[model samples]
Target: MPAQNPTGLPFDDIRHLVATMPAADQAAGDMARARQGDLLKPPGALGRLEEIAIHLATWQGKGMPSADRPMVAVFAATHGIADRGVSPYPGAVTKQMVGAFTDGKAAVNQICSAFDAGLRVFDLALDLPTPDITQDAALDERACAATIAFGMQAIAGGADVLALGEMGIGNTTIAAALCHALYGGEAEDWVGAGTGSTGEVLDRKIAAVKEAIAFHGAALSDPLEALRRVGGREVAAIAGAILAARHERVPVILDGYVVTAAAAVLHAMDASALDHCLAGHVSAEKAHGRLLEKLKLKPVLDLGMRLGEGSGAAVALGVVKAAVACHRGMGTFSEAGVSDKA
Candidate 1:
């Protein structure tokens, strides 16, 4: 029997939701592919843009896909591990950045405005940070479940596509730990200089991840337990949002490493959860490349971006829009009175 949640939504409920989420429309994808060959341009001339259109068509279940209503939700929280010097910035930066987001001053805000994307920031828990994973669980089962439920609300406004991002100091450390646990690798492979940490701070971050793994490795097989033990509220919420977006048939654009880590949690919970997701960009963070590889996703952009807060995803939205336009607006060779290959 599955354990009941304090929110009256058990983990099984989440599993069922994921399992029942709509699969991509294979017929629509095939139709898009057929149309791509008939476009006036040489076949495969647009490369990834052509593939992106097919992917969008499949996920949207429509012959002509449009990313007209993209939403960027930035989930913010503070981590108790920030006090351990994992990040150069103080934990207060999280709240300050959230304020900046609300005031439309952050980079994500600017990118969202430029792309005409709806933006919302969720302060998961600014007043209290999640407990250090090296000492104990970051969140209890109840809090974790509720945080995930909070993430599901991002799609209520009828967003056609969703982009996930995070704003939390020391969260890179949490993301590293979660990646290591879920993907099974050395702590060094996953750790990076988050917020420009170097020297002793980087060493401490790696050591903390090792300690947490040693303590919790046995129980990580259960994805929810792994999240409760080492994941932050924002991470859990991002996973929930991804699951919910897929359930709603809204495609998701995953941001940098931390956001991808949350998607990794969803992937772990159910292999099909990410079928409706796209890798927005490959972050400068080393683990991000590995995360994308593990998910077998090729990022739509690679601008050497490491900034979180969904800035990369927001920028990639332009590429997505172009892809959709190319698919829907291009004239066929016959319509253009052009000769086809003999």
Candidate 2:
């Protein structure tokens, strides 16, 4: 039996939850594959669309896949490392962007509206930035657990698909630190010019990541400890949301680099956490491709997009819905009065 806690702290026993996450239904996927063969088309003609439908069926635990209720949740928080000039934008931009999301003025808001998907933004804490991870822990255990609980609540009333996004001024720095810690790479390999930083700003960002990793490398082998030592609240919440979505058997669509970094944290914790997820798009961020390679996720779209806030995932939702429609609405050869090949 999966462990249950009545105190509402989902992250308190995350290992147990991950251990008990229901595996994707292979029978349903097999059935979906059989149905696809019966559809009136050359085998594999539809290519990845057919494959996506089958994958969705397995995660949804049904022969017919559906992405009817797509939800995009964006978590926003402040990072103390922003003071080190890791990004061109100021920390206040995090709150301002949250306001833009709430007012339906951000790019992600417009994308969600156009796609007819629901959007929710969580401001973890703009004014209360996490401690500078180069010198101290980013979040204590209690705060980390609480923030994770906050993200787990993102899927409301049984959303069919969840997309995770984040907004933090210096998150790329944290992401670089986290990736270096998990993957054992140099800072230059994972760091990038986030928010349009370049030249001296980008160099400083890289140096900052290098310094933080050197300071905390010993504790990083433990995923949760690494998150506490170097992750933003938004990053922690995104990880929590991914785990919660998997527990509920709802498929999750990962957005860009920072968001994928959160998924990386979950992947480090439990490899199965990725069974219920798909890469929505490949971001232009440098480390994004490596991250997807690490997760072994094939992206649904690629347009050189690096604008986070779930925009890429929201755009990719259309493709997911189309794939589901193709899976559920197409007619079999018998139903279409067409003869099957021997």
Q: What is the alpha-carbon RMSD of candidate 1 to the true structure? A: 2.6
RMSD per candidate (Å) reads 2.6, 1.9
Model 2 regions lying over 4 Å from their true place: 5-12
- Positional deviation of 301 in candidate 2, in angstroms? 1.1
Candidate 2, residues 173-196: lDDT per residue as tens digits? 999899999998789999987789
| C-alpha TM-score for every candidate | 0.95, 0.96
* Least accurate 10 contiguous residues by lDDT in model 1: 1-10
Summarize candidate 1's per-residue lDDT along 202-278 as a digit string, tens digits: 99999999998888878877888888899999998999899888767788899999999999887887787788889
lDDT of 1: 0.88
Give the Cα error of residue 331 in candidate 2, in Å.
Answer: 1.5
